[model samples]
Target: MSFGPFLLLALLEGTVMAAVLALTAVGLSLVFGVMRVVNVAHGEFFMLGAVGAWFITYYLPLPPGLAWLVALIIAPLVVGAIAALADVTILKRLKYDPEATIVATIGLLYILQQAALTFYGPDARPVEPPFSLRLQFPWFGYSGYKLFVVAAAGAILLAVWLFMTRTKAGLVMRATQVDMETARAFGINVDRVYAGTFALGAALAAAAAVLIVPIQQAHYLMGHDPLLLSFIVVIIGGLGSIRGTLIAALLIGLSDGVISMFFSPTLAKIIATLLVAMVLVFRPQGLFGARA
Candidate 1:
């Protein structure tokens, strides 16, 4: 293959990475934007989704497509419910104190991780793709499922944007994000909003995990890299900015894919870290975040 085709392949791979990362980072950004709480366990929720997918498909006596469809719907809901429960039980009790919530979520992360390790076991497992067709490019063939991942993520993101921009629920969430006390004054249920937002964020992460698990194996420890990369994306794109998150995910994901293809994964990560540091030094508010 020529360099052009090779690069095109890299770009396609990067788009897949970007699609999943955008969903995960947007979830993180949304939680912080509305609740003003950093969810350290967000990644674990993602891991749980992957494990859930594995369990659902592994045990279900359905056709591969049907099983995948079922897992896709159930996994996110389960993880979201767990997240909502944690918010009510732990974060709410602490009054969502910034420092306290951080510590609490860190604890939650360990708890979920260990729980997964205990039950899900340590082996990495792969789920069969919902479809097996491959699209042939001039120089090579690519997984149709991977292309579907990109499309699915895009469709989900579009739905999210529409929900946030056009729905009453989105308005309430935005209002809460702007001023929790004022929104409460206006008759919004602040507690309920917080719980819902947390759940929504976890659901997004889980959804991303489900989309990517077919390509990447599900493992208890798989959350670590996504978590780290999400933080980087959120920081570079500007915390709480969905548009920024998308842009940053593309930049980081494409760079990582191309660099890893030509060089090393470690170098790609190092470059991303450095980019985050530079962004922090120059634009503390993030690329799209408003100055506070």
Candidate 2:
């Protein structure tokens, strides 16, 4: 078999997949970066976003593109608000005991999962892709929709990078990450920062879900894979490191996409997990984790 077209296709697919992973993983990294808390229920936020996008598209009686736009903006903000509320009400009190926070988040995860199942049913729901922007890449012979995913994700990531590196709020966030007490002493409102960070992180995940729903559809348990992958990306990228998470996500996305294209997705996933394990064994702090 000729390897030319297949290789090109795999590369394109890998790029697209990497974008999706980056969108989902960055939020996980951001939350850890700010609060030093690992949220197990992060995936549910993604599911909510997917569901939100689905409903907006299905019942809003609007054009698909407009509906998706509404979902992308509204879902993230809504989910982010919920997360912010959770942080203030529950997580803030448990800041001193991270283990307790972890357990609480796990419990929250179950609650969200069950709630989704109860409300949305156990079956996977289909999400129709928008028809307005069917960009055709004849050279690649692939769906224009895939390219749109790549472009949209890339734009979002770039925007996030700018927000983190360029804005005043971003600097405060970084400072808080380094030392919350010090940040507070310097007149930073630690509580507000924490709440904002959680909201921002959760919002990012919701954005990813909105972007993905047109392609992946909505389901109650759909958060499982993204949750696992987000954790892996955080671990591999060095927990709380945005740059590390982006790099790790790209690596994992490329490997998963290319390997799955050539072999079985199961094998691809196994290899991905093994790679992360190998990284952990050699560098427990993660590839870009801050050294003690």
Candidate 3:
């Protein structure tokens, strides 16, 4: 293939990656923004989503399209419920102390990993795409499903944006994010908000996992890369800044995809890490983050 074709392929791949990464990183960013809790187990939630999808499709005696559709609806809800349960049972009890939550979430991460290994097994699993169509470009054809992933993720992000900016529930969440004490004083149930936020974050991760599972097999350990990349995106985008998170995800995803296409994945990671280092050194608040 010519360089132009290769580059075009790389760009499409990168856009797909950015779509998934944006969903995952936005979840991470939302949790930090609202609850000020760094969820180390966030990636595990993502892994669980893929696992959930696999389970749904495997045992459900339905058509492939219907099974995938069901998984898409159910996995996020299941993962979100799990996250909410954890918040209620663990983080809430700990008073959401930043340091304490970090340790707590780390523990949760291990527990979830082990649970997956025990039940889901160590083997990787794949989910069939809901559709199998290709769109022919000038130089090549691409998976219609991949394009759908991009569109679906973009729609979800937009819905989230609308929820946060337009809805009363969103207003309450924003209030809590601004100041929990003040929000509580105004009769907002801060505890419920916290639980909901955690659930929402986990749901976003799960949703992303479901979307990408067809492209990448589900495995117990698959969350590590997404987790690391998410942290990088959140850091570079400015913690809690949704717009920044989306932009940074695109930047990292595109660069990683292009570099991996031409060079090595390891080299791509190195460059991403280097970029993170530079961001930390030069603009610790992130590109779109407000001054502290």
- Give me the runs in candidate 2 sitting further than 4 Å from their true place: 132-140, 289-292
Which 10 successive residues of model 3 have the least lDDT summed? 283-292
Report clash pairs, candidate 1.
none
lDDT of 1 by residue, 148-210 (tens): 999999999999999999999999999999999999999999999999999999999999999
- What C-alpha lDDT values do all the predictions have? 0.94, 0.85, 0.96
Q: For model 3, what is the alpha-carbon lDDT of residue 261?
A: 95
- Pairwise lDDT winner, candidates 2 and 3: 3
Best by lDDT: 3
Better of 2 and 3 by TM-score: 3
Instruction: Please list all clashing residue pairs in model 3, or write none if there are none.
Output: none
Candidate 1 has an lDDT of: 0.94
